[model samples]
Target: MTIIITGGAGFIGSNFIFYMMKKYPDYRIICLDKLTYAGNLSTLAPVMGKPNFRFVKMDICDREAVYGLFEEKNPDVVVNFAAESHVDRSILNPEIFLETNIIGTSVLMDACRKYGIGRYHQVSTDEVYGDLPL
Candidate 1:
């Protein structure tokens, strides 16, 4: 199985990549990350040389690039963790957050539909659920 993981260089995404690689040694893992401030390539260094691991540096909002990748990779599943996640930054410049978080997600979904990809998983934080009682 080939899985494309957007934002795979970020904290949670990177951890997921490591876990998947370890658990499914025969599966192909493609990491698509824009290398934003929160995305550290070094975090994925451990799996860099693995035969089943591949990395692509590109933004999820780039429709053409995303489509091309989907066409070439023919991934069975896409796990999206891409977003402008800093609360302060989102408060200061909401447009960027909207573009990345909303538009980027739309582009990814469109590609999935166009290519007939079966699974598209979104990894989101609890913040979207608003404040909750513990």
Candidate 2:
């Protein structure tokens, strides 16, 4: 099965990728990350060369690009870990947050509807819950 993991460069998302890779070696994993301040490409370095894994540097807010990805990947599942931060501060200026969190999520779901996906899981607010152990 192919699983498209959005925001896979962040700590929580990267951890999920590692866990999934280990748990399902046969699965095709497509990681889409915009590499914002919260996202670090180096975090996924360990799995970069894996045959079953692919990393795309793309923003979830970019509808055209996201749809292109959906076309290319034909993912069975889309786990949306993509989000924006500085919640309290950003609430004062929520454009970026809304674009990434709300609008971007809509784009993903629309693509899922057009392209067909078995599941779409949204994993959110690791920041609110506090950090998880690396």
Candidate 3:
């Protein structure tokens, strides 16, 4: 199976890629990322040279680029971990968050529909729950 993992350079996303690659050696994994503050390519260095692993630098908010990728790769699954984090950043610039979190997600979903991708998953942040009592 070919899976597209958005924000694969981020912490959790990277870990998921590592786990999936190890678990499914034959699966092709494509990583789409904008290389934002939360994303660092070096974090994925371990799998960078793997034949089944591919990293594409692209923003999820760009519909055309996203659609083009879907057409080219024909992914079977898309896992979205792309979103603006940090509560303070959200408070300071909510527009950016909306553009990425909502608009970007829509673009991915739309591409999924257009390309006939059957599975799509979103990895949400813990910030929604905020601090919790022990």
In terms of lDDT, the best-performing candidate is 3
Tell me the lDDT of candidate 1. 0.91
lDDT of each: 0.91, 0.90, 0.92
Model 2, span 1-134: residue lDDT tens: 99999999999999999999999999999999999989999999999999999999999989999999999878999999998876685768768777787888889999999998869998876442456899
Q: Is candidate 2 or 3 superior in lDDT? A: 3
TM-scores of the models, in the order given: 0.92, 0.90, 0.92
- Cα-lDDT of candidate 3: 0.92
For candidate 3, the TM-score is 0.92
What's the residue-level lDDT of 36 in candidate 1? Answer: 90
Prediction 2 global C-alpha lDDT: 0.90
- After the best TM-score superposition of candidate 2, give how far the Cα of residue 119 lies from its true spot, in angstroms: 0.3
lDDT by residue (tens digit), candidate 3, 1-134: 99999999999999999999999999999999999999999999999999999999999999999999999999999999988888799888888887888889889989999999999998755442245678
Look at candidate 2 and give me any clashing residue pairs.
none
Q: How far is candidate 3 from the true structure (C-alpha RMSD, Å)?
A: 2.7
Compared with the true structure, what per-residue lDDT tens digits does model 1 show for residues 75-119?
999999987788888778889877778888899999999999999
State residue 126's C-alpha deviation in candidate 2, in Å. 10
Where model 3 places Cα greater than 4 Å from the true spot, the runs are: 126-134
**Candidate 1: residue 32 lDDT (0-100):** 98
